[model samples]
Target chain A: METVDTLIIVFAVIAVVGSAAGAFLYDPPASPKDFVVTFTEEEHDVASEESGSVSGSTISDTVDVPVPMPNVTALELTVTMSPSNSPPVRANPANAVIIVKDPAGSEVGRKTITWASTESGAKSVDFDIAQQYLAGLPDSVDTRNLTAEEAETWAAGEFTNRTATGIWRVTVQISNPGTVPNEETFAISVSGTATHYHGQARLETGPISGAA
Target chain B: MVKTQAAMGTPEGERGAWSSRTGFILAAVGSAVGLGNIWRFPFSAAEGGGAAFIFIYLVLLLLIGLPIMFAELAIGRKARLNPIGSFRKLTEGNRLWVGAGVLFVGVSLFIISWYSVIAGWVMRYAFGSVVGSYFDDPAGYFTDVQTGMDALGYHIVVMVLTASALAIGVSKGIERVATIMMPILFTLAVFIAVYVGFLSGSGEGYSFMFAPDFSEVDGSTVRSAAGQALFSLSLGQGAILTYASYLDKKESLTTNGTIISIADTGVAILGGLMVLPALAAFGLLTGENAQGGAGALFIGLANAFSNMGIAGYFVGTAFFVSLFFAAFTSAISLLEVSVSFVVDQWNVPRKKAALLMGLIAYSGGIIAAVDGEIMGFMSGSWTDAILILGALLISIFVGYVMKDAIDELDRGGIRGVGRITIAMTRTVVPIILIVLLVLAIKVEIVDQYFASIDLFGW
Candidate 1:
């Protein structure tokens, strides 16, 4: 019977159009194609909690986001540190991140959120604190308008919270003693097309033994 | 009650005839669209060469996947029997393929039993998504939901659902549930995918999934793509053959196969659309934090949704509900594959067959519901071996054992496709399946072989 023909046709059209648009919108194969992956060689520096800086391992987990000029629409860039699978699934965790540049740097769209650690019956499955954090971001990228609590709450927070894509040149420098040699060959690949300031990669200091 | 019904005996047409071509298409597509379309497919696209993988997958489906599907359908239509009876009838009393049908029945039971446990988890997750069960701790939620009597409860519910659909008989039950569920599955997946498209900075995820990053193309990419195409289509398990057995002879198997293939591939690509863009929008797959694995979607989306506040609640509910529907339809087909055999081989009625099999699979479902050693063993090694071996056996039986395969296909108006199907089933598919089998064993059992021994303190 032709009862379901319309349903099939509608989905068929969606399939064709979405796939064709995707196929045409981007051409990655024509470019360099290979992923140039490299890890940061930072010293195992566990900084003091008061200062939030580790043993000089680039001030503990710094993230660099290459950005266009500071005045524009919102953008989001994420940084995660883990061992790569030629195709990765889950990898070992790298503890912390410290985005370089303070108030001046922070002004360029700074809201660092720690990834949520879910708990309790009320927390439920669909709750995503990170998404909420992103949604809470102001339409304007100006950091001066932020309340003190907002600045502190959003400033260099963990990977789970603070949401919405913004223009932040984040630098995450990991100095985990628990990390083995070459556990994670870190790679920094930028998303979004901004022409202004490219979030530069900060060098991590070596251990005393290695430095000697 | 079912036993009494079985003793009375019903007519064959009720057990066999599809209500219409549309009904048949719905059922076949139902069998194909599953958790793989939602959970596995997106992760796979991102892992392989993204768009390049898509390109290779389509090619393989056409040159490889579709022909075999046609051949399987042709076999069923020609013989008009369950897998065992059909193979036996086609081969004219040759015992070589008798095991394939039996193995298919076994594999179907094994797969469905294990699948129910997972489907139950998806269902619970759907409920939890709305009610905020894991909002406090997603990892803790996964840990809690993955095992124990709570999981068993969900498993039982899923098995009962599967039985109910089957109990209603083929036309009213299987056809109706499938026709309703498959459309919802497509609509929900597309709905989420379109929403993701409007995300402000989602180009990265889209590119990562569909941009054809050819440099990532390698043996693993091709192997994974080929393997996915084979498994995602629900081949090798005789589900297709069983569904086809119920088809009207007038329906063209080739056209049906093409439509099913398109729908399956479309859902899968759309799944990628749903996931990859959302992750990119949330900043999940930056090469830095690209925790590329099965959990990436769960973790990233959990973060994204949790951050979305109230809107995330509705969106999350929609996604999980869609997943549950997808899992439900596939579970029905898996149950039917085995139930079909019981009806044909024995004098059992359809309802009785569904009940008896449902109860049996339900027992295994309990064990699979556990998140411990026993559950892992059955779901991991036991099921994978059975499925791979089933596929290998089907390919070999059709190619080398069944002499009238060409004629069987020719009976369905398919000419050159028979030769191609035989060639792939005999040669290419079997060899690749072997590799997949070995790799699975190496990863699941052998790699852990030593650890398991230590675990038991033997």
Candidate 2:
């Protein structure tokens, strides 16, 4: 019994000491961090009528930016209206999946992108890559320059840590109305990086209403 | 108090006293520490600027939580009955007083109903940790487990555990289990905090939890902090009062209340250290990528453990197991309230009373588990409302109605009682609680209800 009491006392000391050490020695990120990623927009415009539901999504075209999606901590994607009068966009398929394809049209890796918006009139949503996307990412994929094209892959097979990195024909899908204009400009930029406009947004309808 | 004490008549030797002071402390501490510590407190801290909110909670715990606890303990020790019986015994002829007692028991039962459902979730997570089921996808796993038959199945498991502990009777059951399990629970909480402290990136979590920004202090923050302080200590529902009723006269209510409050608060702060660091390290804060639900957001944090490599499985399992112990101990206390009620009032045997109350609470748990709308109403709005109302009434009864209440506070001349306790509970705490109750209802019920109405455009 005395032994048990002593053990508890020792454990209690460790808990207090350890917590105190953490409290004093460890400091949080004192300031809020803002991420910047440049998006090179691809073709994306899948109509809900063709997709059969307001929640349907299809890949337009993938953007190649300086910092891959994994590197940026968070991103706020804003939709610009063609008429400049579209209601604030309501994004569906709340989780957008970005698939990495090799130059040969072979698949390498994929990451799911999550975003949050208002109940209505939400023209933009912030996607926290570190929290939502990267936590589930395979260690095989390098987080730094996570989506740099295949040329960056280690040479001579002398790689200490290797992951399939090059992505070709990435699929960036979005659903819900007013999120995309007929000829919307997809802007891609990394946090703390210069904001730059990318290619024309082209929406592709997937498996249509009669999709198999 | 004097009239009822004589008229209601006293039954000597009807109930067993706690075998030792340690036993009493453990039982009260066990009841106070549970999901409130793990589930709500950290989330409140996160919402209220981490350290700043914890500061408010501690202040309230001292001013509001401690005084009310002492108030309840004094009443129960003197009356030496279940909450309903204690009230009936204290104010023998007053139906309103008896009604207040009924409300006390009802609130305990109500809280356990939803509480058991969440405990069931903890059980499932603990089980999943061993099999590596969520190794790849924590979000997908929790979403699947949180609804339908999955939730009900686990609620039943917890309900059975609660009944079994209580059926064995108070001393052999509550006192014995509390003595053995409380140490284990405390050790688990501390060791988990220690592990968090050692983790490389966990410093951010500690910073978020322990260091107050002070800028985030606001009305909603106060509401959340105060409700949590009272709720974590099991103040409103008579759990502490019930446990104290089992204490010997030689025991100092003030000293015992302080010990229970300190132990309860220590475990709660430790829970933040255990959980928040991991959540921050994994980047699992509020975002699209974050898990939904106000109080039950730890699922997002628990989901991150699988990503921690081989150590994740062991840590995840141990965390959930400790969670189960925490939940189970508290469930036993809540169950004991209704069980004790039947035993005292209906003259039912302990075993039968345990089973009956357990089954009754199971039906309520089913409602809480199956319907999200109902669960939110009861757990968030109703629980606070009942608890705050219960606290108000208990204070008024003791401070205003009960005769010689000040003299009662002076019992044993324990450290923190007497004129100040009466002024705090009788006057200050109840008034503060009323304002808090109004704010909590607006935030919890009206805001959510209005949001849903807007969502549906009704």
Candidate 3:
């Protein structure tokens, strides 16, 4: 209704037209290139087996796990164990160690687990393999803004011994067999980011006995 | 029934007024309905107990949002000036009240600066939809797009767009754009909701949205609902007040405010329909995957979009385009508050004010884009605290300090609700806002600050 309103409205319309003209007149920045980076989640499980007679004080076995992706964002290993077959054995007080190696046979992750002697029945422990490896690296970088190439390099350095695209080896061992022969049944579950793999871990080596 | 009131008369000295009631409603509604209505509301409802959250949100909207909305419109229309000028006039030059007005401008700047950064991400997503940039690895794409030089570029683009609108003036720039964009936003929202409704597994999402499990309700749920009610309506920051300043007194703030609230809430419900159904269809509505907030919308919904084959492109584009429209309009309103402050308080020309404020806000957002911590602080709990404080101060001013709010509320077609509304504003609104203010401080500010510092190793 006022003179200022009418003039400003006219000016605004002109501005809008000018902006539209500018947008069309000048070339806009190109959109980022389309990238395909699919991440997959898979779990690998090893069947339950009894910790048989220990030649020394440890029982060891290895499982093969397939990782078909080049970049691994996360990896975890979970173990559940209980006293096997022996009805009278209420507690399994043994220490468990897990070691994972890439296709190149270099150790990438290792974790040791132990249970209290008084603990009874089934117990479980989860080890974040990727997190452990990542944590061990120097905390000098903020991963949020890393370029894809930089992220790749950073990831590669942390997981130099942990390739994601191969049949990896995982070794599980039980030690501290004590005089009673603990006789524990354990299952190991491994999970990580990969693509297009049969998500399972198969036993590659037996329950081998080792001298203390 | 909606006749112009001759007694109040048009304020000749006012900068501008909406061309019509419909234009005013559209601009106001455009300000109210934004990303909060889309992504925030559904997640908040789901996390706060679905239907239960909606119920509390509606209640609080009536108790908290509506009164504040009415008060702001009343103050703006009464004084017919920018926020600071309005308070300066209404309070008869009370320095304390004028500073509250200044706080509104400051909060608006803070809100727009960080908001433009986020809206820039939406703009990128909208563009990316055309080329399928984020289709393959939506999660990774989100992380990349939200930071680095790319984010800053988009943020600047958003600020430039908003500044252009403001430089044009109220009726031509904001009202005109909102008139065109609001309908488009509503249509796209409806189209997506109806499209998602036809999906086979969408019933799970509908149930998750509609089925009220009150068992999940808690104090935090109430607090969230209250916060959402305030945030969704764009109350407490003088955007509504500034918009209302450009409104002719013949238009009823009551009817207009109610319509804006209902429209905003409707869009929020529609947003839930679109997002939840799509998530359910993709089997992502439950368990750890059913995360709330930005991650769920950008990453989880992007994953769903990727799985939809060729159709996903069109749908995702429409969705993000609508999101951009919503964010763009709100950004315009927010930037207007500061621009209007500069123009009215400092005697600056409208074009210069818009550019100056826009440039300042844009500079603020550059840091927000590169460093997310500053963005989080500016846009997150601190913003919430300031908004709550603003609303509390407005309620006190309108109901107690200002003598003529009831007269302004009584102006135009609607009448007779002023006494009761004023009574509630004086009594219930302040009490509710006080509670919300304390809750906002405790939950959003103090708790978050302590948590960030890892106080007590929490």
lDDT of 3 by residue, B227-332 (tens): 8888888989999999998888778888888899899899999989889999899776643235456666776777677778887898899999999999999999
| Local lDDT at B130 for model 3 | 84
Q: Model 3, stretches more than 4 Å misplaced?
A: A1-72, A80-153, A156-212, B1-14, B286-289, B450-458
Task: Tell me each candidate's i-RMS in Å.
Answer: 20.3, 19.2, 15.5
Put down candidate 2 lDDT per residue, A40-152, tens digits, no spaces: 43333322323333444343445432221111223233222121213334444244455544333544445554443323222323333223323444456544453322212
- Per-residue lDDT of candidate 1, residues A28-126 (tens digit): 112111112123332322232243222333224434433212111223333333323233211232333434332134433333322221211111011
lDDT of 1 by residue, B343-433 (tens): 7766566777777777767765665565334455665543555566666777777777766676666555556766777777788877877
Each prediction's TM-score versus the true structure: 0.66, 0.68, 0.74
Candidate 2 or 1, higher TM-score: 2
**Which pairs clash in the backbone of model 3?**
A56-A210, A56-A211, A56-A212
What is the per-residue lDDT of model 3 for residues A1-212, given as tens digits with 9 covering 90 to 100?
A: 65445544665554455434433442211112112222232333333334445434566667666443323435454544443433323234567777877666768677777655554455556655555545555667644675544444455434434432345677878664333443445555544333211001101111111100
Minimum summed lDDT over a 10-residue window in model 3 chain B is located at B1-10
Error of 3 at A144 (Å): 20
Candidate 2 per-residue lDDT over residues B276-348, each given as its tens digit:
7776676554332122242233345655576678878878887888888888889988988877777677655
